[model samples]
Target: MSGFERSETDEFARGARALVIYPELPGRASVGPEARLAESEGLALAIGLNVIRKKHYRVRSPRAVTLLGGGQVEEIAEMGRDLEADLLIVDASLTAIQQRNLEERTGLKTIDRTGLILEIFGERAATAEGRLQVELAHLDYQAGRLVRSWTHLERQRGGFGFLGGPGETQIEADRRMIRDRMARLRRELEEVKRTRSLHRARRKRAPWPVIALVGYTNAGKSTLFNRLTRATVLAEDMLFATLDPTMRQITLPGVEKAILSDTVGFVSDLPMQLIAAFRATLEEVISADIIVHVRDISHPESDAQREDVLHILRDLGVLDDEQAGNQPRMVEIWNKLDLLDDDRRTELSGMAARDDNILMISAETGEGIDAFKAHLTALIAKGNDLRTVKLRTDNGAALAWLHGRGVVSRQYVDGDIVSVDVSLSRQLWGQFEKQFENQIERANA
Candidate 1:
């Protein structure tokens, strides 16, 4: 099997003997030590893949042809052949040449971390936008192995041995085709962007607030989104169980309706290519007036995961650099409080009260939900108050102008005049001022 055939083989099976390779310092001395093998197996099981047989390898020689000695590769291949294993899943980046070479030697299909992720995305993508993003990422990864099928083309040719030409060749044409498809994908995503803007505009008109659900994968974002909003989105303990973004109208404790959006979960070492692919979806976090940094307080790396999320947010320019002296309106949802012991929960609660922009609550058991709602209500009130204006309505045009640019909270009408109160952004206020230039000019005159 080559190219497309192996690509097809990468999917799940009922009784697949899967060998997950997590390389360590090779030849240092070890005996079949599985590096995170159980974790990898659990991840596979989440996607319905049955892993029957498993093994691990510790290889040194970072640039070796086999990543190990010839004897070692032969021994491993012999084991696979003896056990009739179905797949080899390497939990690291692998070059096309290395992949093809390994598969040929092992007589089994080979895949890397990137390919496995793309496979999962392909299966989980629920919307047109999600599918397009996955396809774009897949194409970027696949472009490197255009001629993996034809080894003849990889042989020493006119220019460079095993690489052929100095600059480009037929494989370059395949890369160009991928680029052309990507450009078209970018254009299609622009339409998705426009649709997202329209949705944001509609949400901006909502009487409540917008709270975005964000955290590491399987940190229970969807469960919290469902509990808070009475939604039925898929909530499971799996890596990337949710692919598309889902939004629901929630009634918080203060009788306030808020739009709670469940976003794609973050992971450790979220591939750069996948990040670029899913940038459009992540703008939800950026547009979010308030961010709910839900955490799996039980996870060993929970602190590091929180740091990663904040780092990415700041890098994207969404996180403010200012001290934000005012009570941060940003609620830290200490989700999965149900998972913590009473003492741990008490300690965290005290910490949250002392900290700004932090809220401690379990989205699953509905614990501390009232406090979460109250905190959200206060933030919403503050966010809405960021801009407000009172206007005398002698000029119908000015009234009409403000109406287009913002939401009208109150209106009063009397003889030959009208009084109106509106809430708007400063930028929108600028637009209203531009639209009513004639009135401003006459007043100045």
Candidate 2:
């Protein structure tokens, strides 16, 4: 609250100012009450809003007009008036009437948790796919707030956006257009899903293994991935910084190649609608041979972020029963080690050394990065096909194809009997057989 310390008494400043309100469950303080509220406030701050103030009031009854006390509404209104704040940021969804009444009393714009999140998503979406998803979500969230818009629409009554028509109040028409666009976005996304599936099929037939980097937003997954693969991804200090999955083919130290996929970071309480909408884009993580759960070792909420990522993995059906049952190859990359003091960095280093599957590294400064890369190389070596196959000299075309398309182990030749041994996938072997049919038949003949 004290950072930068800007005053909001002026209208120009107040427009950017927000008042965050979180509901305190009655008589129960064991739910880490302060932490939850602080997390909510943190989300508001991350959404690029100026949180001028925040407060928590007890929720006494479901039908209560005021939050807690009889005159609590007016009290809050007076607070708003004093602060000159134009926006009330509620940490829970409000009924349309509730929102309108709150706005009427406070003389300020009122938005709830859903609306604030939707606004953030709307602003952060960059790609066509991302924009479509965000627009659909905004429409869905707006549909529930129709009552608040009805009066505004009656006065204006013009269909400015895609929601309503000329003759109808914008409220009714907005809902209709939302439904229509939601349907269209679904169709387009389905086409995208099919295309993604096709691309996945092609990758599956190839010999390279895939490694997907996933974690909470701003957990340094993209930064780490960029350093590892020498590919640039938009690394930012904001939520949902990278919404699209970016895959790059990278070669590790042992001459092993793998596709590195950097996916959108998972967040706590991510909307279900959004998960369903962008699940196709997350297929890279879902199907990876190995998942690297990157964590911000420097962050205070690192443990909580890890929990969120794990919960999302469970929800996405990525870490299924088999993964839970065994010590799967999923690794935890404890990133941002540079942010830690010497004592903390040493402690994390000790932990990482004790566990083969956990690595502590500073992805930004390349500290301990070589060791991390070596560990990845080891994982890929253990996970991939290291078996060597020797082809006969009679299969000359196949030999040429292997040299052209594969990582060869060794090659030897005698008259009419050259042989090449290489490490490749079973699928690649099938393709190799297909490529050498005539030579194989001739050798048999």
Candidate 3:
């Protein structure tokens, strides 16, 4: 095996170096080349690769063989050799043929954007379900590159006179193996999805509403989750820092208790394979009663990042312009206020004040947290009903159910009957009525 084969396991070793490149094609003016290059470098760093050199090339037209001009390829190859880079990271999608050709010409291991993201996900996945999802996605991505991986098996082999002329090729055998693994992974993932559905059903039977945190990658979602729940998650300034979804019970101002779920962050050009594989995980966002979109207001590309997040949400059916009234309510959390200047902070505060669904706060400084909590409490209360009911003293289960599912204000015992004042959401009230119909003598809402 040459360096290209060893590069897979040794490229991220202590002394190994990598060269990063971003191909800026014509008519791609939404995001600048510098920003793309920086993001690519960040992706490389997330995997512990030592990025030695970063470059951007303006390509008029992409070549099918190498995806870059001959001169550009040669120049990049020369730079990689000069820097002693063990691998090249390309911030663009490449076909298997293009990747093989590039590696052959440059004598370096090469990876594209999708492959890079998949590697990050593979490295950061901590839970069993997360690992399964990552493996499924990796298999899906690798299934398409079998043609380049097993070219040696393309030649026919001599066999017995009556036996087959070419048995199964290496490519076919590998593809079959990948397909079998993918099938098993899909079955496991389906079971995981079913388990999640049961969990969600249990939560529904309870009274607490679920609030999910969603935003662009590294946009302070984990910070806000930690601030609200006071539980430390990996809140770092890195892309895809939180891959597995985490749920914690939090108390709102007047709401008593609510479940807060911190989920994986979104990014521009997210791989479709990840989306398909992690659909079970992202279902949390779709099932949440309220979706809180946390934004890093200090970043220069905040608006663009917000659009990307919204686009992913729309694709997931969590946000729909046509049926906006039917979907779950959304709140915009302008986080990282501490990073801004005094004047900009004041301006944002004024803007948030004018919108009922927006809150400007700093999770790090605990600024405006009380107000955000109060707003969230009020939003949750909007769907609840204050009611008074009477139950028999012997029905302790009914009383405990009410206390667990709702906020009980006053209670009085008279003879064998108990009078209770409580607040419950419409759904909980319906459940209560169904479960305690005979025990209740009178009810008023």
Candidate 4:
């Protein structure tokens, strides 16, 4: 079988039983152990794993060899044997030696949180650029763990390719080869980044504003994107359901056309390798005209999820203090109202009513979408400038440009000159001056 097809049958087979463990360290963790474990289980399920058992252990001090203490490791090994688990998934980062020791003790294939997430991204990334990024991340992650059998390298199919099947023969490769492959992937990704930058530049020259939807994984971003743009995108009740960013043209009140983008979801403790690999994709958010933060209001840890999303945004420089005044117009959306009880919903509604920046809606039921669109329209038109300009009657290009770039309120022809009144954003105004300023007779603002 081909590598990818083999991955489906071998790595993510229908009944591949897995043992999931989350180590809860003491101190102030924003998210509770229960919520964290639940999220981990959801991730395991997303990969087609039958999680036979899940547990959370409190660790006062972590061991260098194994993240868990000796007693805890022995208990896990015993549990694995009892449950007949084929895989042990640790909900934390693991060093190479730690992973090796765990596998030896438990006699089950082991992977850490980063490895699991990479596997999922590998399978879900549809675009060529996305695949390239995933591959690069996979290589970076596996480079350190090469001391273990490299059988996982054979598992590369649709994803970064490291989840080897049980009883598979282990293979070893020189680190030099891995280094060379990673270097090449970085060069190719850089090219992709440049091409993406050019596309963004062209869009900037265009008249349409860009709106990006960002939130925690499976937070209804794709659903809301579909609701607003009337475009069908993959919206499922699973973690990282949408990996590749999708963009579409949408019309808002008083705006002819606006670009809407649905981005990959953010999770707490997302691997740094992924952030670096997907920087090109995340740049879309940096260039957006408006940012809509979608939240799953029904989730018990909704507030903590919000903080995780914001932390990533800050890391992306979106929430930097220097860019505060210049940042994109921000809107917070509370989604999945249908999943909430009436009392809970009423409480949230009151909170949203008190905050102009927050809006409550159910994307599936089409509740409050009109108000959301109107709010976007107001934000886009907030600082627009109204101007009147005169151009030669024969200058049809300039007239068309004006009509396409902004909302034209009136147009009149007097002899060989055309007089028009229009509304233009500061950005569009600058572009007009650079492109057609000398050709115009005069402009009054």
Tell me each candidate's TM-score.
0.73, 0.78, 0.86, 0.86
Clashes of 1: 1
lDDT of 3 by residue, 89-171 (tens): 88888889988888888888888989888888888888988988988887788788875543322232121012223686666
* lDDT at position 158, candidate 2: 40
> Which RMSD values do the candidates have, in order?
7.9, 6.4, 5.1, 5.1
Q: Which ranges of candidate 1 are over 4 A from the true structure?
A: 1-15, 24-39, 53-61, 64-79, 149-173, 205-208, 253-255, 320-329, 383-445
Candidate 2's error at 267, in angstroms? 1.6
Model 4, 70-136: lDDT tens per residue? 9999999999999889999999989989888888988888888898888788778888888888878
Model 4: lowest-lDDT 10 consecutive positions: 1-10
Question: Which residue pairs overlap in candidate 3's backbone?
Answer: none
lDDT scores of the candidates, listed in order? 0.67, 0.69, 0.82, 0.84
How does residue 427 of candidate 4 score in lDDT?
78
| Cα displacement (Å) at residue 300, model 3 | 0.9
Give lDDT tens digits, candidate 1, residues 400-445: 6655444555666666556555555555556656766555422210
Cα lDDT, model 4, residue 215: 96
